[model samples]
Target: MNTQYTDSKIRRFTIFKRLLNYEHLSYQQLSEEYFVSRSSIANDISYIKKQFAKEDLSLTFDNSGTFFNGNEIQVQKLMKRVILQREEVMDIDNLLMNQIANVFHEAIEKREIDIPESHIENIVLSIYLIIFRSKQGYTIKLDGKNQLGRLFFEFDKYPIVYDLLKEVEKCGIYHFSTDEAQHLTYLIVGSGLRFFLKDEKIPFSFRDRIAILIQKVSEGLRVNLTQDNRLEEDLVVHLYQLFLRTDAQTTIVNPLISEIKQTYPSLFGVVWFALSDFCKPYQINLSDDEVGFVAIHFQAAVERLKKKNKILFVCPNGIGTSSYVSAKIRRILPDINSIETVSTSKLKSMDLSDVDFIISTVMISEQRKPVVTISPMVTSKDMKKIMNYYIDLIIYNEQKITEKFEFSYETRELIGKDIIFGNFSTKKDALDYLFKRQDFSDELLKEDFISSVWEREKLQSTYFDNGFAVPHGNPAFVEKTAISILILDKAIPWGNQMVDVIVLLLIREEDVEKVEPVMNLIMQGIEDKEWFISKMMEVRE
Candidate 1:
């Protein structure tokens, strides 16, 4: 909210930039340069050290001065983080960002390159930093031994990427070395860019891998998606892009990852599990952002497979009221393709087999189809009721397997004395506490369980946006199903978001079916966090 930077912030930003450029200045020199006291300069250096610490780098002091101790890649990464965090402070050049973005668009339009719109900004930012750092005589040098480094050295293999770099060279007014050009190439291609050449071919094995992914997900969700040709085609392309990103050790930050995880918690988890299995054989590790992107394709396929609702309206009063209500309903919900209106007298004789649900002005005795009653003149309350019914209907139609997800006795029993209330400063502390409380069986190895949990966390953070985190290990490491709840006295950073409530979900392979309902309950809690936390307090009592 504070657009104006304080003197301290500006001084710190200047020092960060100088240090990023590998400058070493003592406290006295910085104090004289910034017109500040030696103590103020010391504070600035201390702040800079903390920032480096966050990135897992150390700022060392020697006879010369204090400097960041890292390699070229680490320096570049730290620069990016600092620039993004202090964008306003740095007064980033909008013209430069836009110029770089225009070059990418031009390349994409000319068919010289292809990339998803989501990653255009990533490339733009990286190039912006490259130009800035390169101009200052700091150039990236790739290590020859690593996979990415090897790919970088053989950059000419991707002729399209090499050509694109030439165009980028003109925009930045800098002749990039093999290492720099290849680094840019990796970014362009890894950010979901597709290379199309007349003689190029997609291997059959690649498509086979996608098929296995679909089959695994289909079996888990009990939905037959293998027959969907569109899903297969979409996934083939997406997985190729995924493979590129994974190989390059980079991924596009998915802005909708939180929403996707929250809205379709079960589907998201299933996709994560299925994709994890899919990537394992290839020894590829994907970020949660990638999983979220893949989940979107499957979620889209689910939407496509859903049956459009057909509503039957019954009004005993008159035809005018029925027509008006039907028109209103149609306006409110465009997804309903069919709406048949009839009087109460004719309703009994009409075929209910085709109707998914019945919306009536008067209460109708139990018909086979689900019935909802509303006033002849639809009020806001009535509209809300109708929308709620429609949402539940679509969710039911979309995921038929989750039809029986009500809070029953078993659901209550799943959350018992494991409820904990404490203050944890970090995600690891919260997870360590919850893991300690769990009663692991003889069949379960604690090390394996801990490793799987952290591994999953590394794959993608379990922190949801509802001030809660649901951390779980591989189900194979568990002998029983349990949901350990931890209500933090204060919220802690779990990953990208802050979590006040932590739900450590542990389950066995046999209880895989329970994932959906349990996730549904957590999602419901997220919708009304205050009420959920209050209820949690009562349980603690």
Candidate 2:
């Protein structure tokens, strides 16, 4: 096993666990817990302390004990990065297995070794099973290769082969080889094998070589074999190349495509097309719904890849927010094709380079990214103004694409802070308050409050899932208006389901008509089950 990698993982895990358990734990205590010396513990602590300091956190030792007084959110973020890095090692391990398999196959095909086809098959199958079991954390017992009688039994047996196999089982990969053996075995266990072993089942066929490879490599690297058991530099390069090639050719069927298609056909189509293009080089075949899911995944991957200019948006679910956003960008900047509406989890992983501007009602940190935050209950006039500004920026800069556009301002202005909160037991009561607030102006109220909702609902219901509705009318329908919110004591039927919360939006017809920003905000806020529930439960006055 790679001792360096192993030690690093252990140190990280130790620090993380210690932080969670004791707000204050000394380096000495950590050393004792991990059975490491004081100096080593101190070194690790020093490194962590430096990282914390960069994020404006202080690590200090007091009379009581040593503790980290960094921002809790920052600490959590760091912890997540540490955990995800560990997960990435698993992926690397899987790649190593594929490299080994390709090596063996190529060797046999080139007649480099005089082994029978059956013998080769047996070797592959045995290695596959061993990797499968190891990934599942199960004990493996393999029959000796000598029993196959494929090669003459040597008078002096090399124990390194067996030792390497054991190490591979434990760590996912091992680099040791016997003097007698001319080549190395890069063993891997794939996701399929991991799944099977997780369920205590055995694979019936040997066709899932890719799965086996991934599982073995993941297990091996996770156990710290990669750094401890160093291979010849040439061999490592070859293995890496082979693994990349194999992974590029690997295909995974998306199980959720059918569900996505049935539920969201248009979204499925857009995703499917986008992913088809993205995975073209890798030769991965994604289903329509899977494409949509992959589109979201790609959005996340791109965000992580860019890692700057964080953007955030919130929008109501299934309310044409995503589509509108997509359309408005397409209309204003026809070449800006990479824009996507994603859930909050995906947003968390985003690279943020293309995210100079943000459009949302929710209160996300303005410190990390330049934002043009807005209310979910935005007026059409407000939406038009925001969209036009962005569009104009895109056009004036001659930036035909959203990615080319950068934020010139540090922050955009906040809109509609003058709105007050009010709650009503019934839709009528809410409408009454809205009408009364308009000074009993019937024409103005109908045009803004009543007509706009009727018009928007014709396109699609604002009712997302989980008993909520964002009702709004077109800005053109209003003379003058005030925004009103209603929280029904009981679920009132709206569109397809009973909605408990209704956000009545009023806007000017003269304003640029783009629902995309508002839609994006709504979707962003309610993407998560917990957050959505909390937002719904907000007390209305």
Candidate 3:
């Protein structure tokens, strides 16, 4: 009932921690313990109440005393926050923390649970907290509405969590009740790190949601990602756990969010926009970290879309020369993924559907795909011809994809009407110039539009490491689509980066499909500042 802290701040923290432990400390008890006035205790409680209100938690009192009035999950989060602030409260020397971590590492490796390195520390700390609290008889009491019981199924689905806790119990000389065990499992599941559940089947709901997500992104990129089974599987595994983590109100940190956003800016924007719709029904506002994770998957799918060229070797000459020519072509052109030698006779029957193009020693009269005729010896002149043809084929494919959009990055159509050349000193000045453009006069006038842009900017600066920023508003506020460009004459501070260019996206609700290509253009500029500025200057001229 009575405790001594070095200072009022520490005393307040202690009181908050005790409340998290389900303690109902009265003013009289706390004041008497601290050798302070009752009003001083009241001030402490008032300060604690303000902190609790920040998290939408209530610090209430009754005839018993003052305690945290919230669900188990909220209480546990507050406890974790408090302990993490002054980890000494959990363990003065961190001996117990290290001991629990070691036990966890052993059990985790034994179970072969594929947890991300970022999540391991949080998981270890959570397990230690559960055991520490249980030893002190601060056991979890779940109500009927608590999804931990239903979502986790009490460690039956994740026995590794159960086993880890059992191991901790052996090391710490403490026993966990059923509720404690269940709480520990909930903590693990909530971290959003579980992957490769070989024994567990992914729910159809998760798979279905992932399918819809892939389709949405596929439409945006003008490429079908649904056919990529690996992408589907990766997303299903990630998003299923993400749903569980959301339900549990847990967060997973992604250290590479900034790099990911810059590296795959186009893919990141597409994923972020698509996930905004995907998360609306659940009311789950995903953090940039989560969006970055999903964007990584889509970026992989984009790489898959750029499949290497597969060549079908056709030689009217005998098998010996055919083999020689195929070998020679392979040695010369490393870009070709595969070369299959086929006699001209068999070429008629062979499936050209699987082959990207035909590489032949003899001239083919008809061609299903593009045919490149080279010498039987693979001569120097023929090598140049083949290389040119291959280059043309790749360019052709890229052109076909860009054709899906009405505007290309090279053309002025995307940013022509809205492009500005200014020497703005601040980010707001640059954005203000873009917002007032005639291109966005119809759309940016809405108060909601400006508010949404600032709101998103506040969440995370759109600044890229490549010396540019791609600031955007919420798609919901956009009715007419526009890509506003601000090419600064001098570099200005934007978030953590110095930006000489700003590509502000005003994407409409219906045309969300265009986000990818538009972002691709912006990223292209970011990668080559010289070329992008020259192009914009050319457009201006």
Candidate 4:
């Protein structure tokens, strides 16, 4: 399917600007405006109509008045995101749009809406786009169920919003609808940034609702989260913004929807169960996108609940800069149980058995457990390294999900002469070439082996990092226990990680316990990539 997004535009943001207007545009005008053919407009309309039925939307272009016969507010939300994204285009129109956005920016600065600085720019851009659409002879309509907040408007609040619009209107722009003003009001007020920018204390009414909501969720998930402060506060803030967007029918597309569902399936399920019947007053069923967005809060809360590892910093630099590093680590990684700073001389005398990991400003050629070499004043790349190492430790300690992920540190029966050297680019080519060289039992079909690997990769890239991926299939497809390792000619892209080493494990259901140790060794090999590559190259000869 060569579907350019369902809402694909012939000209950047132009297709939608015309289609979503309250006025109906003929094909000739649309083509002339967008600098495309009438035939192209027909094709674009056809493509959108194809998605309408499946997406639960409607488009009627007859005497009954040509308009997309669905939630116009939702369409308006769609337009806001589209127009805002056009900031990337270097054109006269985009320049003017950015200038209009500045008008809202000034208004927000004056009123102090209590939204985070990061989000105020986005809200400003949305309002600017709304004003632009209204000026273009479009009467923004309220055609959707007001599923967000029942309190539509108050005279006092709206007058301030009107003041915000006065600057754009002064330029002899078309008079926009009162409804458009109300929509912008909700957008500005309902942003999630409001909760964070104001105070640490959440309002009791919203807090009380969130407490009950958590209780309902706990009942659904069958987990007691009654007094979880982080979960409660985050959820309250999330729902506050979610309500405004819902009322405005603002369509927020979460890029991490699939990734979140895959990474935290259990949590995603718990959220869906909780919100399915919970948000009824809002009038519509909760969407997967909404559920996914909410799930991120729960996931963070879950991570916060993880047992914090004790990190000991061994910086040889004077205590002044060393202390700075310790403070930086604490601020960056709050999940750390505790941070202990020690001098090189102190480290020499003290026992390290109780330490989780070691961080040092200067490299100590000989020391204890995994040492992360970092600068006293940490850089972004250094932070990434610290985060990666910390997260690995966290995931490694979680042994409860054993059947899903089983690895062993003992190298006795796991890996040996199975490691093979290779020169390849793509994952499929690399796997295909490597697997073909392996001797499978009569009962094990070669195609099944390859297909199963693909399935696992799709679920989550088995790539660990530093040029290594452990791709494997379900044990049901394995007739015998074996291992085949491929060292790529160069690192090839595997999901987000590039991998030069492919550790293909063929452990049968019966051999998982014995074969599990290979996973830890493989991890260590990848972590100490330079050494591992040299050691393997010797064998390749």
Candidate 5:
């Protein structure tokens, strides 16, 4: 091969692309084609290899020609990036999607299959991999002699499945068996975004289960999440695919697992508690990857339920840059309702009362409100500045919401050192232990206070965040107005939430006004959960 070349970087990349596309170009042919000597051609190839090395790509030269030696999947990903970003549609132009779209359109129009625009990529990738593997002669038994095979058998003959297989055969030399086509059908249907249209009806049992799951999580997190039908619809689609993947013993690669776990630990904990049992029936280990994906859905829903803010953009760099900065803000922070821009001269004169905060290109001389200063272009530094402020504001706002329920009550009557219990397991055991410690009037028993508390717990748990479960009955059922603190010896699983601290309320019928204040106290516990949990654990009898 040639070892010398001219200093042209673009020519090197062009040669590299040709090398990837064709393996028959010899050193002599390339040297003549590029009007360079044999040594210059080698130098160009060497330069190409250096560039490839930076991208984690490799090249080899042999008697035939230059060969791209890399993992096929990694190479495919690199090709997709180059074609989408660098070429900018001078190349493929989404031809793969268009091809598959043609096949899916008929089934979709006929209502034999429902496909969502959001999941077109998944469908395309599924078909691509199935065809690729089938060409390599990968086979699975089609007949339902086994339990798992029955799922395929039920759908193998469906008109939609047969049509897709026939269409796929047109693009390749390989033929798909009925069983393989059925597998593709399940993958497409289960993972498609049809749920967003809200026309698809899931099974009653599945719908009920998802509703209960969301409701319990909502109760656990102290938020109203029932109205978000999108969340329910997405989970149904996700869980259906999850079940199929589990049955096939396949694992998913979640790119955002680390980020999600770090950003939303409490929400991650809530999701784990909610879905751990749901995985038991399928007998599959609930993986962190799956949890991360589920957490993303919940995080989006929570963000939607948050209060939107109005912002002011201060850019001395002119309207064009200010508009670009505003677009970036809207992209990063969907919670922003409106943003009004101003020049440095108008900074002090601007009506700032309606704005929640200010993002400035230059530092404000006077600090009247919260201001985040970044360059006009908006970089990651700006992202952090905006994100940190919102996070702090979120904590502050949460505390403000709890403030209304906080009041000075000197009578820590039922919350003294004597009323706290140190050891308990099940809810039944915890209740029995509490009952043994006190002698109540017959009126409380006649109202079935204990039975009512037990029954209420069955319907929905009283467990909120910070390892505290607030359990109480109707004021009418109570004979005494008291607060009982039950600190467990260890955390016990309490209806999808673990509990190490139990605060029992036994308010008298007339003193029912105290519940809100007590709940505010629980919110305070959540503010410093570690400290609260430590205090509960160390409380001695």
Candidate 6:
């Protein structure tokens, strides 16, 4: 049989032996005697009672106490079988000791402390060896100074030994004293070592010590194994406290956010956005640092939300088919926030500057923000397309911000035969040509094509110089493809600048995937002042 199975049998036998010894004891008393929880004791007692019943061995329990009347020899024989099956349990303890040694070795290699890896590993192994042998009924002898000797004997107490062993078994890291006697015992446990943490009583305040201890333990466990209970509890509590007192806006300023920024700055923007949304109900103000912390939580929450199909609904014109649209959206989106309804006139007038994405029945002309428009007769197919579009946009924006920025070499690198460049005399002229063309099959780009591109420009002026306005998608709202270059004979009012050279990129949903490869090229075209001016000067109708 597998050694793990044998170890399990031994554990079961140990529980059974303890139960047999205290057959008359109440479950609560048994729990105390075994140093296990009441539930564990009850479970063990229940299993033992079942076994007795299976064999037709009489057993009774009540207020008068419990008794077992059966073949004593047979009971002893069964107990021996369990004991024999558990012989490998001792080996498991030894293996755990060795695992501790390896952990210390790794920590040392990382140059975490001045202590030598070999020395730490040996010391931990020795300590565990002593404990393991002793647990197997062997006496341990120690020779060291009085303080060290006292620590070793105190460590032998069942409660302390059990606590330490349980921690090592569960967490794969045993924190023990580094006194000479304890070190010697640790060295003996190397054969069975799993991992070990030698307590370092450094010259620091209590709070500092706690922080240091938690850091060390978390680092060790995070690398050698999955995060343990202690780490999860500590991290979650730290985040909770950081967010608890913070208002939605200032939550981005926490130290945890700063740490994440240092490691991942690009993710900082998306994370900040998520934290802002999360803290919305609490009305907490977030700082950059707090935003970083919230980003981590947001990433985790989103992963879970994806599996559950969570969604939010937005509609313009509350009076029409908005309710029906909301119901259809609810069927597709899990964790659905209430469907929000706003009038088209109100939508056009109201500042939806901070809204995530708007889904509307009525098409508002001034959609200067992120909005997904659907017809009043929106069908299931329309819902699917809109949901997919929104989800893709969110994902794309996140990817864009997270990617590293690169410099482009020239304008020709991005604008070529497949990509055209020109300037428009008026926004109307540019709008007319882009929508009127039937060269492309993508309808989303053809329908309201001018407004969508113009909306992006309105968010921020795309003009890079006196003659150039590089109007492109927020890289978040693109659905279907086309890139247009319009050269205007005269300057026109574009956002905050007058422009003669306009490079309007019409990108399809699929083309957005190429943003990474062509990003540098686009940036290069915008940055070349002389080339951009030259291109504008040479533009024709």
Give a tens-digit lDDT track for model 6, residues 304-406.
4343322234454455567777777777665444556776555556665445566766555645555676777787678887778767866776676445444
Q: Could you tell me the TM-score of candidate 1? A: 0.67
Clashing pairs in 4: 408-516, 408-517
> In the order shown, what is each candidate's alpha-carbon RMSD?
7.2, 24.7, 12.0, 14.3, 17.9, 28.8
Query: Using alpha carbons, what is the TM-score of model 6?
Result: 0.27
Candidate order by decreasing lDDT: 1, 3, 4, 5, 6, 2
Residue-by-residue lDDT tens digits, candidate 3, 440-483: 44554556788877876665566643667778777777767878
Residue 524, candidate 4: how far off, in angstroms?
28
What TM-score goes with each of the models? 0.67, 0.24, 0.53, 0.51, 0.42, 0.27
Give the alpha carbon lDDT tens digit for every residue of 1-541 in model 1.
2222238887798888888777888988877777778888888877777666434457778999988766676676666666555456775767777777787678777974555565776677777877877777887887753463342234556787777667777764567787777677667766643454234445787789889888767765667888899999888777765665554444356668777766776687778667765775555555566778999999888878877789998887777887789889998899897998887788878878879899998988888889999998899899899989999987776565434234556666777557777898988888888888878765248779889889877765566545867778877789778888988889887654567988888878667556655666666577667766666666542
Q: How does candidate 1 score on lDDT?
A: 0.73
Query: lDDT of all predictions, in order shown?
Result: 0.73, 0.41, 0.71, 0.63, 0.61, 0.44
Best by lDDT: 1
Model 4 agreement with the true structure over 93-199: per-residue lDDT tens digits? 55556666676677666776456654565566565556555556555676544645454334353455577677667755435577777776677656644433353
Off by over 4 Å in 6: 1-233, 236-320, 334-339, 375-378, 405-541
lDDT of 2 by residue, 260-347 (tens): 4343332333333222223333333332222444334323322333333223454444456656654554554454435556655565
lDDT of 6 at 512: 36
Give me candidate 3's TM-score against the actual structure: 0.53
Higher-lDDT candidate of 4 and 6:
4
For model 4, the stretches where C-alpha displacement exceeds 4 angstroms are 1-56, 60-67, 84-92, 143-148, 151-159, 170-174, 192-208, 216-224, 285-287, 311-335, 339-541
Q: Who is ahead in lDDT, 3 or 5? A: 3
Clashes of 1: 0
